[model samples]
Target: MFRRLKTSQIVVDVIVAVGFFVIAWPIETITVTGALGFEYRLGSLGSVLAGLVIAGLFSGALALRRLSPALALVIAWVGALAQMSLGRPPGFADVAIFGVLYATAAYGSRTVYWAGFASALVGALVITVYLTAGPMYAGGLSWQTLPLALVMLVAAAFALGLSWTIGALVRTAVRARENRDAQQRAEAETAAEQERVRIARDMHDVVAHSLAVVIAQADGARYAAAADPAVAAGALATISTTARSALADVRLLLGQLRHRQGDGPQPTIADLEELYAQVRTAGVQLRVDVDPAAQGEPPAAVQLAVYRILQEALTNALRHGAPGGAVDVRLAWLPDHVDVEVRNPVEPGAPAPARVGHGVIGMRERAQLAGGGLDATEEAAVFTVRARLPIGDPA
Candidate 1:
């Protein structure tokens, strides 16, 4: 509840209320000297009591700052009338203080104008009572005081309007700041979610491809050992190498979960030839056409993206294509872009496979991250995967 009141406004209200009471007490004594027909000292005591009552009224109004403006205005007006009726020379201070309180409640709402109207009416009434009654009871009422009361009413109206304008501006500034902060927080969360999806895709590509190669080589070694010792030994050696390499790759990927900064080695486009050799050793006939003149060195992220795409495409071919069928790998390096294509003959009876698995999704995501694209298609008896990476464009 306290959070609603601005600290400066609270302090100002308290100070103003106390100041008015201090000033009004002494002035009341002088105004009532001849009219009350009492000793000046006794009149001064009465004035002090009146000042205390008015102070209580103003303090009560300030305490209700967060309440409805209409309710607070009604309370303040009642207190102002009471003070005017009891005091020796009724003053406009009560109305002026209430006007300021009403203005404060007007911020960011239409309550200010209504409160101002009510305060002005009450202020005019208090002034009229002071002018007619004080001197009339003493048999010497004057006309000069009417103009003074009118002047005070005009000044009160101006103060109320000015304060309301300032309060409205302050409320607008606060709301704008809150909206800007909310937008920044939302953007940060969106960027974090995208990074998480990218990491999941990379993990799927690495694990799926490595395990497929190891399984194919192990099966070849088991079948060939009885027929030819030399071929069986070669197959076993290739299986061992494939398993070790896969283990290392898994370790590298898992390290990313531990630390984001320099936790393991990063593979790039230069590793593509070694990748082809492994698939060839697993008994698939692999053909490679890579241009040496192509931009040999690309940005680190682009290099990693290209390596992952090729890895996923080759793995899919080895797992799904005909045994010992030709898997063609093509790389065309242009002045402004590089294109990679992998195509393999589809095995019989598996046309329109059940689903394109995570491998294809990973390849597509990597291509997108590098400001490129991937397309996979099946035409006639062949399945093809193609990716294009732009050199200078970073999306």
Candidate 2:
């Protein structure tokens, strides 16, 4: 309840009202003289009651300042007029005018703010005329009185103008802060969307590669089951292992939805041997040649990119290339980059893969993100995937 009250605008305004009342109530004497040739003073119990009542009216008006600045300013002006009617000149109760003017400039609409500015000019003129024509000055429309009246007019204008200007400056600052926060939120959303795309690409690579291997092994097992049961058992074991690994990877990818980065290690260039063994077990003739210098461990990010590129290339070759065709993989280490090339024979009369295929798009995106480039081409029944990735610091 206390927390709620603290957060409530009405409660905060009430507290401000109470504070203004406390400060303005004790001042029973007004500084300026009235038309009666004497300074206005409230010196009796009845007069004290009148002053407190005026203070309450002013404070109550101030409490509504933020909610309705135009209304609050009008109400405070009414209280000022009542005080003047009671033979009181300018006094502490008039301080509420500053707050009301500030609210008008800070929160009021354009129509309301312009109206408040006009009111300020008019109010300054009225105060100047009233103070100069008072009985205490003992003169009317004289050169001596004119100078004092002009000074009073300028002083009043300056005071109100300062309050309004301060509120206007505060309004500008609040707008700037809100704009900055909105931009930050937009950037955060963009980052989250990019992360989701990355996860999706990773999931596709894992599932597609595992499924291709399982299909190949299942087909081979079906043909060999009667002739050699042992061979079929080995094929079954390969399918089971590949399925379990794929399931684990899928779980890790889904965990990201809950903002959890799983503790599982990411596959890297070192995992290429296992990947190669899997493809060979699926009956594809595979040959790998890695440059000795490039075999040195690279940064984790570059290694992960290399592994995904290789995995996706092998999966495509096994799925779409001629059955029992030879796949050639070559890795060359240069001074600044590592180059990977995979070539497989396309079956005769087989249509070339679509240029906008999701698998090819994912590989291209991954290569570019890793500071590299990738290209796929089909020429004379030969399919090729080539990628060049920048090498990071030795790991």
Candidate 3:
């Protein structure tokens, strides 16, 4: 509730209403002139004080709550009647206050807002007729006052209608702003969730692929220790290298998760050679046909995306491709674009692996983030994964 009203606005409203009543009460008293057949006097302290109190209360009530239109009209009628009976003579000035109040309340959708306007108009007409009753009986009713009364009524109605329209417009604008803010907040949350999922996929690819290679090498090392000590030592060396690379990858991923700005080294297209070496050590025969032009330069983000895509593809191949089968990796740098392909031959009767795993999804996401395209297909003993990245602008 406090959020809805400004302190200064509330203060201003209170002061204006109180001040108007204070000034209007004395004016109403001064209107009590002689020979009007009304027992009103501006010099009467008690009557002036009483009128001031009444007017103050009336003004304050109008500002307080959601006043009904009917109640407002009744108050208007009563005030008009009092002003006519107690003031000097019946005139537009006597009932103008009630008309203004009625219009405000009616436009505000208060209970007595419209009613107040209607009642004030009616009361004004009644007072006019009452003042001219004796003369009309002696002669005839005059039509001169009709135009003035009609003008007042029209003005009041117009003011009320315009204010109500403005209020409705303001409400609509406020609601639209609120809806837009809510939509923005929801979109931000969804983007954050998607980032989280992408990070999780990266972790899965890094850990699973590294551990799988380590496990295979350990097994080979244990088996060849007696027969081929040199081969066992080589396997141990591969294990150590795999473990260190895995640790570095983990640290980079954690830095990304923590939102650390430029905290870790990012892999680029050059890192693909090292990645190929790791896969080769894992017992996958990797045949590479990389473009010399694609060896050195790319945008940092694009480079990272390319590296991740290749990593995921290689990890998937090692997990599902036939043991000892050759995995072919092709990188071609066109004048305007870069193309990457990873394909492995599948053994006969091997079931297709899960398609929605983290590795596959992560590759797809990375390609998309880099403003590239990727396709995975399995047919006739061959599994192919291809990505095409536009080099026109860095991601």
- Best candidate per lDDT, number? 2
lDDT of 3 by residue, 1-395 (tens): 11245667667656766666666666544444334344435557755665664565456544432333344444545555554454434432333344345334423443344444454455545654654442322333458655654665566556544554454465467669999999999999997787778668778878977887888788889999999999999999999999998898888888887883443676777778888888887778999897746644666767778788888888878778898889998888776678988899877777654364556667877888778888888888888988988775645
Tens digits of per-residue lDDT for model 2 on 118-235? 7688878877776678433345557866887898899999898788888889889988999999999999999888888988899999999999999999999999999999999999
For candidate 2, give the lDDT of residue 278.
Answer: 91
| Candidate 1: tens digits of C-alpha lDDT, residues 197-251 | 7667766776777778888888887898788878889978887887788788777
Task: Estimate the TM-score of every prediction.
Answer: 0.71, 0.83, 0.69
What is the TM-score of candidate 1? Answer: 0.71
Sort all candidates by lDDT, best to worst: 2, 1, 3
lDDT of the structure predicted as candidate 2? 0.82
- The local distance difference test score of each candidate is 0.68, 0.82, 0.66
